[model samples]
Every structure is written in structure tokens, then in C-alpha cells.
Target: MPQQSAEALTSQQKTTSRRPAGTLYRGREGMWSWVLHRITGVAIFFFLLVHILDTALVRVSPEAYNAVIESYKTPIMGLGEAALVAAIVFHAFNGLRIILIDFWNAKYQKVMFYVVIGLWVVTMLGFLPRHLYNVFNN
Candidate 1:
């Protein structure tokens, strides 16, 4: 067996160390997009579940349903609703990015991720002001 020279070993280690572990997306935009997608997905799911349960309260007791609905009118709940909308917007746009990756073989995944984020920001910007005004004023 031949022993590698110190310079050869050092150069090899430097190159290999610079390479990230795991997949191409291990710590990049793709990884964050994937993580945010799953998180927002679960958040949306739980929000929907809570919404359904609260709506179902109407069948059990109209007064209880009204009370619950009224409680959601607070500023805190308004902020929470904003977060929900943000999550929904991100999830929806990211879903489209995933579809493009799968069907269109999108090579510019990082670009697509940025596009999704930009779209989400634009959408939220359009929505938040009026919604916040209505929530805080009424």
C-alpha cells in the first residue's frame, strides 16, 4: 500500500470538507423550502381541524359557537390569522414549485424557491393592511 503525501492529504481533505454532507439540498434553499413546506402543511392542517371543530360547535350549541367566534375577534387572534394566511400562501406557492420540479424538471430550483417567497411576500403585503385595519378597528 502507498502512503499519501501530507500535501496530497491536506488538499483532499480541504476539497472534501467543503462539500456538504447528505443530498444537494442538505443545507440550502431546497432544504429550507422542504422544511417550511412540511411545517406550513402541518400548521394549515391543524388550523383546518380547529376550524372544523369550532364550526361544528354550532350544531352542538349556537351560543357556544358564537362565544368562540367572538373570542377570535381579538388583536391576538387577528395576528394569528395573519400567520395562518402567511402559512397558507407559502404552502400553496411551494406546492406549485414542487409540481414544477416533478413535472417540468425544473433545474433552477433555488430560483423557483425565491420566486415562491417573493410571491408569498407580495400576497401577504396585499392582504395584511386591510385585514389588520378591519381587525383592530372593528
Candidate 2:
């Protein structure tokens, strides 16, 4: 048996460490949608917590509750509402997709991605016009 030289061992280590050529990380659409859904759901949940707490202030005192509601009536709050709506829509629709995948055994993982994207686009298009109208009218 021949012992490898130090240079030969280093060369072998480099080759072993290098990734195989032409091997790309092909992430599935379903995986990406799942990640985004979890993130948005968490964000929406946090906002809901704050909203509930603020509304609870009304039980303690009407003035405090009114102040909080007045703050939410501003344009910034409108934008925040729009964001919350988006998050809810995404979470709901994607959750349905996940359910379908689980029960229906639909192998259309990539289709799930496209469906989520399409839903998001349609939702924004539908909501933006209404939001803009309200903003301008008020």
C-alpha cells in the first residue's frame, strides 16, 4: 500500500469539498409558499394581538379606546389595513392549497406557487382601487 503525500491529501480534500458541477438547488414552489405563508401568518398574528389589546382599552376607558381608533383612521393605518388584508388573504389561500395537497394528493407543487402568485395579484388589484377611492374621498 502506498501512503499519500501531503500535497496529494490536500488535492483530494479540495476535490471532496467542491460541489458537483451542474448541480443546482432547485427549490420547489410549494416549499417557498409554505415559508412565506408562515412568515406572513406570524406577522398578521402579531398585528392582531396589538389590535386586540388596543380595543381592550375601550373596556377600561372610552377615551383611550377612542384615541386608538382615531389613530387607526389615519392614512398610515389604511396602508396597514391593506397589508393586513393581504396577509390574511395569502395565509387563507395558501392554507387551502396545503389542505388540498394533504388530502387531494395533488402533485402540482409548482402549480401551488403560481396559484398563490395569481391570487396575490388579483387581491391587490381588487383592493388597491377601493383603498385609493377611500383615501381620496376621505
Candidate 3:
């Protein structure tokens, strides 16, 4: 038998390096969703800590609490609100997805991408109008 040429080896490597046939065991959509859920949950938890600290200032001194509240009543605070909303929405929707996965035995491993997209669209559409109304009115 003749030894394979370098060019032939390269071509063989390209074709044979195909993905393993199975349920994309790793780096699947469900895994990505799980990761995003954890990340957003942690971010939201950090924000909650700050929020609690700020509110706790009221117990220590009303003046300090009032100052923090006043700072939050600004355009920059609206951005914070948006971030909070996003985190909460992601957490809530993903939590529900998790529950569905458990109860219905759904194949979220396959549909997780669409599930996330749908969650984002529905959450934004549901919240945007109310947020805009409050912003404009107040």
C-alpha cells in the first residue's frame, strides 16, 4: 500500500472531521439558556443588594434614604429601570421555561433558541407601552 500524500491527508481530514452524530451533547441551546439564566440572575441579585442597601438607609437616616431616592428619579435611573426589567423578564421567563421543561418534558434542548427570542419579544411588547406611558405622564 502507498503512503497517503499530504494533499490527500488534508482532504481526508476535512471530510472526516464531521460533527459526531447525536443529540449535540454539549454546547446545546438548553445549555446556553441555562448559562444566560444564571448570569442574569446573578446580575439581578447584585442590583437587589444595592437596592436594599439604599432603602435600608431610611432606617439609619431619612435624609440619606431621601438622597438616594432623589438620585434614582432621573433619566439615568430610567436606564437602570430598563436593565432591571430586562433581568427580571429573563429570569422569570427562563424560570417558566424550566418549569415547563420539568412538567411537560419539553425538548428545550432543541427549542431553547426560539424560546428565548419569544420571551424577549413578548416581554418587551408587554412592558414597553406601560413604561412609555408612565415616563411621559410623570
Task: Write model 3 residue lDDT over 20-76, tens digit each, in one string.
Answer: 457454656776688889999999989989988998998999998888888887766
| Candidate 2 local lDDT, 18-58, one digit each (tens) | 75445433355655786889999899989989989998998
User: What TM-score does each of the candidates earn?
Assistant: 0.84, 0.78, 0.72
lDDT of the structure predicted as candidate 3: 0.79
Which candidate number maximizes lDDT? 1
Evaluate all candidate structures by whole-model CA lDDT and list the values in order. Answer: 0.92, 0.82, 0.79
In order, how many clashes per candidate?
Answer: 0, 0, 0
Top of the candidates by TM-score: 1
Clashes in model 1: which pairs? none
Instruction: Name the regions of candidate 2 deviating beyond 4 angstroms.
Output: 1-26
A best-first ranking of the candidates according to their lDDT comes to 1, 2, 3
Put down candidate 1 lDDT per residue, 14-59, tens digits, no spaces. Answer: 8877746655555588889999999999999999999999999999
